[model samples]
Target: MVPTYLERFGDSVKFELKVSLPQNTLPKNTVYELIPSFRYGSQVYAFDKKLGFSSDSIGPYVSPQTKASFSMPYRDGMEKGRLMAYGQLTHQKTGKSLKTGEEVLAEGIITTSELSQIGQYYIDESIPVMGLSVKYGDQDAYGMYKDGWTELQRLFMAYSNLGFAEKSEYMKVIEGRGDFSHKNLLFMELKDYDKVRKDVLPRFDRLAAVSMATTEKSEMEIALLSRQIRKGEISAALLNEAELAAAVDLEPGLGEKEVLLKRMCEVHPSAFSFNNLGVVYLNLANRSLDRTEKNRLLASASEAFDQSNGFFENPYAAYNIGLVYWMMGDKASAYNAFYRAMAITRLDELRKVHEAALGAVSIYNGDYRLAVIHLNKAEKNEINLFNQGLANLLAEDYYNALIQFEESAILDISNGYPFYGMALIAARNGEEIILYENLSKAVSRSAYLRKRAPLDMEFIRYHDKVGFKDAIR
Candidate 1:
């Protein structure tokens, strides 16, 4: 029979204290609460000492169907689904640790009282252990799980045989023989890593994608937060799996870009939101035709990027802000933005983008020499090569300019910019036939270039020519 005092305390005989979750959200790798014995002695409690269960609390939210997918905040990197839980067992009134039996730990992180400690009474816990003599079935879990149905059936049977007092992690806190409310604080790692990945994660990813795509705003957030927990850079496979259930794009359906981003920001305030919001705004700006609206979108993009900088000093965000300035035709601001990004960015790949942006801004600013220097530093690519040629042409370096344009042409046969560069060179040398041939090819490929050619100063001499009018038309 349980004592009246123990009944009133919900048999909190084991619980010295329990920490409430912050905003009802589970945190990873945090020491939630200390569990000191309320009674000072070498006695081991059943729930506390033997099994590690405490009083009633909400079990972590898990999927009702699969029981795998849950609201666990995907911890970054190696911390995903793993933690080193630490705790100490101290006396209730003596204020000293009880070093009894063998000090054990979930991962040896807890300062368990050992043989070395003075004035520490070892509390012996009587617990049964079970192990299979032959290690059961196939040692290679992957090969065994390939026969998944059979393997899981055998595994479940094995688990049932291994018992802990006919009671599961569920413990109710009532006065009589039972408690109405129950809770489970224990978590387990999947023993067969490859097996779980092959069988479980795909289903979870499918759910993640569906939740993210649906009109339901609340579920969409949890799905995105789950995305942030990948140990490595997210693979296309996982994203593809998630997209299978989506009928429409997640971004537009949510709401206006700013409103959607703000809601996301409130739910999950991470660099992921800040960076992606900048991108969405930048894309919106590009799509808008009205100049004032475009500028307004660019301003929003810049602000999103600026907010991202508050989370982390990222060159990706910096370059995006620079791009917004460039599109708005603010050459000085664009170059300064790129230069600032370039100075702080240690990654060569990101630095290349910053350098190329600075080069393009220099071309527009009429700083041909600076443009050449910046363009040369950029990674060799069709776009950068074409821009380099443009800068060289402005500086009257036709030989270097032609070489750059020809290389750009070879890299991307479909792009018309390189041919346009060659036409400019021919126009400078008074080669009308050669100039008109290249100009025709350039105009046929690019609508914008075709529209601009007739009014271009470089093509002024050819504007009156029949071939030029034909190409422009």
Candidate 2:
């Protein structure tokens, strides 16, 4: 049987059954009869077609083989059903029954196609929490801080260029704050300055509201948004860039979002905009099929991510750059980017963990034991668990690999990679039947594995086996 299990395509469940008769099984005047049927629960449905063979159908010395195919209408009850074939030997002349036997051809039906239209979606929820801190520091060991030196320099220049009308009072307040240490600088709220001095400059208005402070800080070090202003008007370019970025954040289609984000960059380039642009390009590249177009998009994505990394050191851009470099076939660069991503810290814990796993895998190269340690840090989701299983399998820890694979399969029943991992372990252990069983389940859930099984070197020993070929088919 080509699929030792049934598979449903569209509205039909289809399968093939192969029956072989030994030489001389059918007497010269006798006919061997075969009947096929499906059984689900208490219901039994027989196939409309019947198969029969006689001595005249086979040559004198050779065994006879035949293949029967069925495309049965799929029903909900048949999901857990079995196909059975019954054999009978009868006298051809009088049609008298002589011997009878029954066997199960295939067990159960895989209806993974039923879940084809399923998709993932998320609900928007608002949560009140502390936002980015006002503190600026150059000791960005984890790459979390923005460029404090650049902002501080701009702040000093802004104060240096202030007009004489309000310069004296502003200087008085600034001088009263003591030394403005670069490492412990703070960006003071313009509203707070308005309380201290009545005639505060209108140019000092903040583009965004400052979140309520949850901790008290020393007033010795302060910076202001007035650094961004010029000639009595707020920075219109910055305002335009912010509006465009907000539109981009609304997540238009990739093409539209790419255009808007590029415009935002042209208006006022920033790490955030470049990183998001890289993500859009990466997505476009992934969805494109033409090799030339895909290469072009990947190159652009790589460039955008590199620009983002140059502007600001962050894990998202590093991880994205790794992905783009990986797709570009630059394995060394990809490994370096992954390493950087692993070293960087971010508020998004899961993304950081995923990047760490990728980094550890790349850093260790083929040292899968160390990779498993890093992968274990990830949450026990299907992808993470499957990766853990793969790492263990490569490390030659078949016992743990099997456990992880099983756990992954249990978590996501429709996922084929876990079963495929189990199949690999079975092949390593020389368990041919177990390999076929798991491989069958794997191919049932994944069309890619169905095409890959025959060509995969892991199954080389079974390449010539009929069962392996049938399973792959």
Candidate 3:
């Protein structure tokens, strides 16, 4: 590793480092960020216990640099030391992340689960950590600072996803004892900021607070309201839409959602929040463990969705309304909701969500043909394939269902539903041997399927068969 050169300009100090790396270390024509994690105080300057990361920039000749300025230790009496800036660089490829210039052995690399197990070794809680190797051609990185309230990797993803205002809001909240804009952040390239963010932004783990309506409520206010909600002092009337949404997630259990969300939609009346409220009620109904309360909670959920569609022509709200109605056993009403959802023009971000939702509701409403249409609109994946199989099965297109289920099973061998569908499809066609094989595979993966098989209507024709009994046994 080459030494990082330091220079002082006014109150801030700037430094740069250049280093060698493997041939073709970074793909050409792509942008990458040089993220630096910093530590302050005299204790760390002499030596710090945390494992440090040091790297020399690879191809395209990285000239990573940064600047820092620190005030005197304390405002009142005295603290320990002035702030310090530091960085660690790493390279990730095909599920391996190694320190700078460390060769990730081409074979028998660590699995994702193993890396997480390795992460368990981090007991310091104070030191930040890092992650995954994107598939080839997606080697991109962006800069983010980690500190209290935002050290989690998900926060970085949220920063990438947010608009300028939202990103600034997050930086303002988490930049404890520091400022970000003045920092001379270095990236390997200056391209794909928007594209990279778009590709990675809508990942499954979105930061709830960052994603919510923060323009109205600051992070501190939401934090305070969340504390009150957790402590059983949920004053729904006092919290705004964002706080109420956060409360929906923070509330210990199902009890507060009924009150909190109802009040939330009453005051704020956003289509999105109401759509979430519908989901919350659906969850409460699902978790009640009492069949008698299911219809009532579902009805309340449907009402919440009714209010949502009143606010905006939202496909998600309409789709959710359809889902609750179907659960309520009102098939015609569910169909109407699905109809409205499919008719509306959805936003780019919601197009796939809307397609997935409509496809699911179509199956519930017994519109198998419609289900197939909507499922086709969605991007093909294990879930959609399984849903398509369901649609085909119910529509009595046994051959098509068999093909979809077989494909879905290959995608997720451990998911019992696809195998279960295959078994039922084989039963419909009187392919006795195939039926027994898939039935055994399904029950082996999930014990619940073993119980459901005996009572399942689709398998009724072959229930008494000796093979069926033996497979479940």
Candidate 4:
């Protein structure tokens, strides 16, 4: 007779067994018997009448264990969401049986959304696993296996979703002195800053106050919030009041705060706090009305920039110093600083510095060809088109200059420099219609640019012209 067969369906198995009786049975006491057996990997399971009554048990007993056959159905192998096994039925007395074919079933292909859901399920399941493992296992073993796995999965999933480095960063949180829960919560909010600001910022402000009741908790919260701001997720304005309050809470006076900031720069040179202090000095220089104060602040800015360079050769620091020198009218020093910044960084802002410095140097040195070369390179960056237009004006290339200026003005409607350059170019070329239109636009765009036009050497020829003066004003 043919052997029995089993079919597998998603974590369950069903099998059919066939049993045949002996050709002759002598007496009523003769045993008619069969035992169902299953094999999965190396483990074997059997169903027999002697083992005790089971719902899956089959066959009848008789005086003698006769050669008989019977069919039995079974549901077995219930772990790991998979089933792989074969089945058979044998005579207990004869120890002989018919074979069944192997059957297997498995799960494959999981979507990202499904994986996320599965991860959540695993996290939830881990709580029960932790309870069970703690109850059964020793403390150290439970910590290493069950609780560790749960924590690892939670942290890894959290970090991965937030685009953070995913290589077991949970250990850092565990080992660190600060509150990891608050840190993780802040990280989640920072991952979607606009969403958080819209939905959670107000709540966060209230929570921040509660956090600040303790020094250690307050410092950790501030540090995490600062990281988000530095990453450009949260606006600086959003934290302005909070930061001021914290500063006042921690230290009494603004002067003392400045001193502490300086000390912070010294202690954590590689931190962005040092670069930010340089920015503060640069901002002060920009606002100073007294030439002496402006010069002193600019010098202070340069010192801060130098300090920043000691920790990290940040290009923006070098570029800001270059800007300070340019504002101080030290053209040579400005160009050298810009060149150094350009050499150190390939950032687009540094490219603008290179172009602006090159344009200024070329114009001062009377090398219009070099000015054009540098301006053209700058224009390629797309960000420095207005400066390129100004450089072209200095180079006396009116037609190309007008084109560059027009393109730049189109990109930023409020940019008046390009309009001013175009106006001057048009007036010098005796294009009265174009000159009046562009000059009017320039004056409309920027009152400051219009006021400064008389002092601008690039428009010197048109500055005294009655038509140009009337049109610009």
lDDT of 2 by residue, 356-431 (tens): 4462334224446665766666667666677777777766789998998999899989877789889989987999
Instruction: Give the CA lDDT, 0 to 100, for residue 219 in model 3.
Output: 60
- What C-alpha lDDT, on a 0 to 100 scale, does residue 93 get in candidate 3? 34
Pick the lDDT winner. Answer: 2
lDDT of each: 0.48, 0.59, 0.51, 0.47
10 residues in a row with least lDDT, candidate 4: 111-120
Off by over 4 Å in 3: 1-224, 229-240, 250-252, 256-259, 266-269, 360-367, 394-399, 456-462
Better of 1 and 4 by TM-score: 1
Q: Taking the tens digit of each residue's C-alpha lDDT, what string does model 4 give over 1-473? A: 22323322212233334334333432222333334445544654444432111112333442222232322232233221222334344455566655457554222111101001100012112121000001112221111111222343343454433345423343343332212233344335434545434544444434433432222336556656545544547544433333522432354333444444454444333313444455556655656579999888778777876665554454556666676765665556766776776665344544654665565455444455666676665645222565566556655777777787788777877655567677777756877778777878877776666665554444445667887678766
TM-score of each: 0.47, 0.51, 0.49, 0.44
TM-score of 3: 0.49
Clashing pairs in 4: 19-69, 19-70, 20-69, 29-63, 30-63, 30-64, 31-62, 31-64
Q: After superposition, how far is residue 61 of candidate 1 from its true place, in Å?
A: 99
Number of the candidate with higher TM-score, 3 or 4: 3
Model 1 TM: 0.47
Q: Which candidate would rank higher by TM-score, 1 or 3?
A: 3
Ranking by lDDT: 2, 3, 1, 4
| Ten residues in sequence with the least summed lDDT for candidate 2 | 116-125
lDDT tens digits, residue span 82-106, model 1:
1112343444345555333432221
Q: Compared to the true structure, candidate 2 yields what TM-score?
A: 0.51
